[model samples]
Target: MASALIEEAHDLSGGAGDPLVHLPDTATALVFRTRADGRGDLVVVGPRTRAAYFAGKDLAVCVRVRLRPGTARPLLGVPISALVDRTTPLAELWGGAAVRLERRLTRLDGDRRLILEQLETALDARMRGPAVRDGLVGAAAMALSARGRERLSDLAPRMGVSERHLRDLLTEDAGLTPKSFARIARLRDALAHGGRSSGLAQLAAATGYYDQSHMTAEFRSLMGVPPGAFFAGRLPALQRC
Candidate 1:
């Protein structure tokens, strides 16, 4: 799995704004947000299959640790399939521990960097616990993230498993089938290069889609907007993913 930890701070104190919608992707994240009132909350953002909205005005500062596909189940102590397309509060999973973390975060009066460090430390402590990681799932996720167009037929052989078994593993560990994961990976690849591309057809071909129309359909389904509108800076809210 290709896990990453990142911290971000957004200042919405200037004015309250509408919630921003985020397109679905493969990774699950641990999100900690602090409001202008010094209240803080911890949430586990599950692997999403559809677009979900979040209010921008509700956040003053935000920190996120993006977990690789097939990795969250171990840390969360539940099958990731249970979290598909869901955003649940950490208190529901971690119980009192989440509450204490929130309390500590609310009490902190420090720079963004300091707050981020504290959050990282808390996450590190959790990682020290036992986990049930699936090596096959991680390897598959890594392959898809790097090359969305990779054939499942070929992938299974490399992983030393039948294609049918691979499908089952992906569903249980990543909350998605190989096909769905590949689609998300391809969409992400296209979006990352959207700003620098000259046209949709060229971008589509480069990103491994059969054609521009194919790419357009997938983009609309996942992003709720066409490539033109999305790259035009008309997104509902700024997204870190």
Candidate 2:
């Protein structure tokens, strides 16, 4: 599998049990289902996107495809932003998301094999035979854990690559540069760490921000709100995630 299992949070005994594909900080989780007859709908979640509350309620089936690095294309048939909290049908995201296989079947009504096959095909295409830069790419991602709060420039040389090269390699594997993903990862880490920050300054310093102003800009751009707003739980969807 191109992706791995990150976490399952809770048991899914009652719902359609689709294989969950874990992605790095930037990859979208494409969810779909397949049938034995070779037909299925595909829902591709885009980068930094969230799913509609109603989506999960109805569709027990989903296929998550983590995008290959350096590839900034939309996942197959689904729009990148379709999952960001809306009641729109999967057809709007992709024609596949609207196909209802279960409604037409008898015994196999709930079987999501068709969707899984389509995803397997898609993954096969993305992963192919072998990776050329697996060593350098994998090393760079693992290195981030050890270099927490350090700037990209400071960590690049130790990984035996230029800062630009490091970013390029990271983009190829994770769909985002090391520093950008790292920043998001750090922010997510801080958000989950849970506590009232003294202020933006303290939060910035803790998350490797050079200063409050810089942290504020970065936070606003990616988070779509001020850093304080996140701390205050103003973004309800994010809080739920």
Candidate 3:
């Protein structure tokens, strides 16, 4: 089923001059933008290694299709590693093929359902073609996304591959090394469980950190702020979008 290949497809509307913030995330997103002249543009937002800020003063409403791991290479026809921390137009990768899809989406403008359906259909078609991806790599990514406690080296033998091979494939397929992906996944879990716990220490313990200080160190490294500062909104720019 396509469920394993796609996570979610949704639309977002932003007011003029609005500021947006995104935390470190590993998922690759395919965003659809419709211009004022009734034409569509497809943008590929690669996996992010750090938090990013965007000031979209002249933004338009857009639809985003967030993809699951093991799906980007086949659907986009590129190595995921080449896309880390980068944003590219679909036309740059697929050339005329991308332009044709944009025209199709433009025709479906004002019909969000049709636009989304067309995107899915296009993805399904692309996925049926040849691709260089590893199912084991996808499995490793999912495992890390769930707990962030396993290592590629540890998972390699189970997947019937060498540790070095698994690590290399992971970087190529997921745009993040096993360790880096795990830390981001751990941070995601911290954010999720952090909302329920009253304090950082409790949240740390719940999310598999050695202690609060350890979690604080990771937060500073990945999020640019310690848990206390980030959670308490000590930095005005740290607001969640």
TM-score, every prediction: 0.82, 0.53, 0.88
lDDT of 1 by residue, 21-109 (tens): 56677877777777556778778888888765555554566666677556676677777788888889989888898899888876775
Output the number of the TM-score-best candidate: 3
TM-score of predicted model 2?
A: 0.53
Model 2 Cα lDDT, one tens digit per residue, 45-160 = 44452211111222343344444432322233333233322223345643542454223321343454544444445444644534436356545655563336456787788767
Clash tally for model 1: 1
Better of 1 and 2 by TM-score: 1
Most lDDT-accurate candidate: 3
User: Model 3: runs farther than 4 Å from truth?
Assistant: 1-4, 15-19, 35-38, 56-60, 131-134, 235-241
Ranking the candidates on lDDT from highest down gives 3, 1, 2
lDDT (Cα, tens digit) per residue for candidate 3, span 166-216: 888778888888888888888889988776898888899899889999999
Of candidate 1, the 10-residue stretch with the lowest lDDT total is: 1-10
lDDT of 1: 0.73
The CA lDDT at 70 in model 1 is: 60
